[model samples]
Target: MLYRKKRYRINDYVFIGDNCHIGNNAFISSSVKIWNNKRIENNDKITQCNL
Candidate 1:
């Protein structure tokens, strides 16, 4: 449970570069944006996720 990177609302001029890891109850919103550097592991276990 660790996420900071400026609240991750990067878009309109995206830029993400580093050893990133995004997982554990994941739901990246606001049009979804990604620039560089990648690592996303979401252990799915949802019965109802409507958003």
Candidate 2:
């Protein structure tokens, strides 16, 4: 996904598949929870994410 100063908020849980791509200026809040066994590839410009 392409995020330019955009925020992605996960209330309950988040499950990402393999070869997932996250673009620049992405914001994942601290309340968000990421599950195990998921793959996340951040190309560049990571903004906010507790994990």
How many collisions per candidate?
A: 0, 0
RMSD for each of the candidates? 12.0, 10.3
Cα lDDT tens digits for candidate 2, 1-51: 985673443333444444555444443443443444433344332223333
* Candidate 1 TM-score, true structure as reference: 0.26
Candidate 2 lDDT at 23 equals: 42
Candidate 1, residues 1-51: lDDT per residue as tens digits?
Answer: 996543222223333346656666544543444435665447432222121
Task: Judge candidate 1 at residue 14 and give its lDDT.
Answer: 33
Q: For model 1, where is the 10-residue window of minimal lDDT?
A: 6-15
Query: Which residue pairs clash in candidate 2?
Result: none
